[model samples]
Target: MRFTFTCHATDGHARTGVLSTPRGDIRTPAFMPVGTAATVKAMSIDQVKSTGADILLGNTYHLMLRPGGERLARLGGLHHFMGWDKPILTDSGGFQVWSLAGLRKMTEAGVEFRSHIDGSRHMLTPERSIELQADLIGSDIIMQLDECTTFGSSHEEALVSLELSARWGERSKVAFGGTRATQALFGIVQGSVFPDLRKRSADALKSIGFDGYAIGGLAVGEGHQLMCQTLDVTVPELPMDRPRYLMGVGKPIDLVEAVHRGVDMFDCVLPTRAGRHGQAWTWDGPINIRNARFAEDPDPIDPTSTCPASSRPSKAYLHHLFKAEEILGQTLLSWHNLGFYQDLMAAMRAAIAKGQFQDLRARLRQRWGFAPLD
Candidate 1:
């Protein structure tokens, strides 16, 4: 099937839509669970699907380092290798390389870094990143390789990085060639916290043209206010017809606000990561299952939840599992957290469709303990 998106409804800046891919349709204001290393940590593929997730986000840097992209292609690509039939979005591995800071060197050509696993040397260029994600992994949506700067960089530094990313975006497009029939490529907007640079990056990508656009370099400690401010200036510059994705973002409040600002897609490791640490997300913020207060609590995480992990098991049992260091605690919490995220997304979609997104956003802010929006 040809890749396409259709906006079904809109309430102010917030909207709901469907991203049609050959694999399946992804609902708008969607949350994609991060599957770095071909797995979503503690949750099984079936468990992830049960959470109502329409897509998964894969990390190209890790895959290329380990099982190897070539090996994946030989074995019928990541979908076949990982047993996931849904649409998958693979990152260009630019952020991973950027995170390697002291261990990596960036040049006009690409990034060269030592593997965190075994200190193995690797070079990741825009062309190589595209080939790995598009051809080898057979990803439904492929991201372009772009340089990511720190949160407090000077405007000059951000501009240089933005220009370099734009250049790489061109190279990535050339490398991607023509694969729109079965796949799509997304260009990332990177400009730290500068509004003008962000617009420049977005305009540059629009000139090159892409199936989608991703806002990168936020949620790296710029705080919620600055991130939203950046979005206010950046999102309006993007084409309304194409899907807007916010990469590596964030808490429930962040998602609520980003959706309100017109972002259609998001991916983060927060839910599963918090779960592994014994944190469970709920409508009323997050609770730590390891706390002594839940020792004798007979209630489940959420009695109304459809997920077994959130409705079947009692809080006492989960606390015991965590206290005993059983692996089941991680698995259960991960499942419940993902389920909560999906529920949040579904609620957002429903609210947008009903033209009541503002009401939903206000309620969520109060529930999640965020200050009321100005």
Candidate 2:
């Protein structure tokens, strides 16, 4: 597979670029809405496309266990299965394997765990993860296997996981082979919160080589400051010409901060999860529609926002829906939240290309009150 990253412009450490992949071209400073289990929960493919998302993420752990890769292949890959012609990126399921199952066994070969749903046994090695992702969806960007540990983990534990991920990254590359001509494999850099260990992980992955690099194992529990510190040391060591992804990252402020630290792409569940909880992300800050303050408020969530939820639904209506436990309310809110995130990413890319990212980030943080490290 051939992957090209072209840097369009730079503002401080932040830069805007376009990633040309066989599936499609993705504008840098991109936000991939999570479509775990091949669906962006509460929203349809057409609905998600309207949000201006260039790519969507699918979960390997979920799909492999449920409909299964073979079933997806028979169903004509994820694109046909989901009706999303745009690019699809799938996680290696390493993180899900670590987080989902009740018990898991890890070794140099791979991981063995019982399915969270029915306690069925399964093994997910680096080879199998790559095979499943490539042979099934043939995703545009594929993540390598990596151990995701919580923040404040011991340095030794983090280092071991980092080294193992590097090894798995190599295995994934070998398993990917040439048949994945349109697909690209990315390595995940995992080192918990230690800067030195992060560098070590970066160096190891670079030696192995990858289409892109992802800053994994972060945002689990480490606050924004520590995560940025890790990126501060980690990004400079990576090849600037390649895309850098910060996985499972969060709030608007977190996105801005990570961009400032040189992250090119991101994916998070905050927007959708928040929307399901009757919350909305706005220019001023995140506000819960269920809050009593919105009981009588007639204004839209954010009239200036592009997200349909932000302007289409009134605060009072949204509050009523959330209070009444209506599903449409959550669906609309999720759509709006996703739209807001895409809009934010577009704004960030534009601001960086125009050399105004610093000012933009500062203004956002000031207005958002430092983005509570959720």
Candidate 3:
């Protein structure tokens, strides 16, 4: 899809924008819920849509294994397959092919690995990744097959990985290289956390060219501060016209900070994963439904919440569901978490449009507090 990024506001190094795509218009500083296997876990498509999410994400590794990409394609692409007709972004399967595979081999061409599910063999190159994204799944946004390095790696190790990733990005562009269609290919900049290497990666991606740029290899294991710093250096290096995406990012504070540093798009599994465990993300803070304090609190999770699940159900009842091990516990919490994310996105869009991002961010950080989050 053709991406148009508009810098609506700037607070220090932070800025906000909107990404116009084929499926829809994605307001920048946007959070995309991870629909790993055609679903966002406990929530239905309409439930997810109600969260104010204009876009969604799919995992190439997971879908290629479970329902199979070809099966989904035959069923009418990911949109029809998942019953979500919005903009969908799919990771290139590089991270999972390396992290989830039992044994993997890498060469100058691509990487080969056995599927984590059935032990079936698969090969993932830039070309294959693009083909998988385009012909098979029809993702609105397609990411390049780049190495996602760990935080603890040595500078030399990171350098090797980043160089390989840069080279692979070139190959991915060649594979995805064409006039901009509804599906836009993005290049991932991977350098672990080293600033110089990040510059190199960004420069390489710029040289090769893409419809967008993704700050990859972050959030793998690095804490938030370093992640923010890396983005501070990396985001400015990307082409301003194309969208700047921070792949697989985290919590409320992390999102706000990255937005401050000019990241436009993100996808993460935190909300739903936490939801399944009985945690609810609210405008105030994260509330654990399993806590004894909520057992008798006869109040909606968020009475004024835009999400139906949060505004409709009471915390006391949700707590009862948790204590009774009812499936509704997961459903409600998941709904609330997604709602919170959507609310965050809305606030960011408003702040940017009003040119009051710094003020809004300070207020959010103050409301969220300096208390350490895990």
Candidate 4:
């Protein structure tokens, strides 16, 4: 349960580091593809590993309601269950409950909600959330259960939510005691869009102490600029030596900007989700295979990509597969998208190590047709 972060270099605010865990060492400024139900949709675990992902994100809310946590423990943990020998990080089931909206009841104790799958009842407190993540799911990195506030909430509401989440963080830490040798518990910083409240949340989590820190409550609705602004204020308040994760974030540009603001880890479903809908992300930008122009185009999605989809398949063939509703199209596109994200992360890591992150960032902006926030 020993976790260590070794920072190798820093280019501006962006940093390159390695996170040492029991399963393996994860290169920081890393992207974790979401495997919400213990499986990354449309892709196999080996396929996911082939993309050079050092870690994967599992959803505590989904697994707990599906096969159940105790079932996963009996089956020898999530890693064995999913055939992913690499590290796994599981969210605390808070965000899912928050998203449940009218279906959930929130109080100082915890959240109670009906399962989205079966409409069954369940309660998720901080203690139970830690137990599910560490004891049952056997995740290497576990997150504290925190209330996820909405984007347009009032200042007072955000403050109250942040304080409650800090209290829950204390409970999660106490529950994670002694397991610190093999498991890491991270405290989540939640303050909506208020910078001062974000600072307060960071200070509270630091006093409570955690193996890592996560910037939550962003990317829900606040656009890229506001999200980065929140990170700008919150990141410096956290311990520089611990890994900083930006949860449920973002497109390719979002990853670059977050890293520029000192984020070390990220997980999102953008790549795979977009792939399922006949979309592809390239170094240049995103393209829709469903478009009529692709029906006659012979070029590959990304001529520079080494992935099979981007290297072997023609744009016309991919368009045909999607047009005919063939399953292989989505699978291949998912592979390519994941591969692209991994390559991007690797490039960023190298650029930061070589003190050329800003150069790389500018290059990517130019290629992707994006402009930096002014």
Predicted structure with the largest TM-score when compared to the true one: 1
Residues 137-220, candidate 2, lDDT per residue (tens digit)? 667788888888667779988888888888888898889886666788899998888889989999999998888999898888
Top candidate, metric lDDT: 1
Cα RMSD, model 1: 0.8
Per-residue C-alpha lDDT of model 3 across residues 6-124, encoded as one tens digit per residue = 76666666666777877788877789999988899999998898889989999887888778878878889899988988889999998887785347887788988887666788888
**Which pairs of residues collide in model 1?**
none
**Scored by CA lDDT, what does every candidate get?**
0.95, 0.88, 0.85, 0.93
Per residue, candidate 4 scores C-alpha lDDT tens digits across 177-245 of 964687888999999999999999999999998989999999999998888888889999989889999
| Predicted candidate 1 versus true structure: per-residue lDDT over 163-258, tens digit per residue | 999999999999999755889999999999998999999999999999999999999999999999999999999999999999999899999999
Note each model's CA RMSD in angstroms.
0.8, 2.2, 2.2, 1.2
Error of 1 at 11 (Å): 0.4
Backbone clashes in model 2, listed as residue pairs: none
Candidate 3: misplaced stretches above 4 Å? 371-374
Between candidates 2 and 3, the one scoring higher on lDDT is 2
> After superposition, which runs of candidate 1 have C-alpha atoms over 4 Å from their true positions?
none
Lowest summed lDDT across 10 adjacent residues in model 1 is found at 365-374
- Candidate 4: where are CA atoms >4 Å away? 372-374
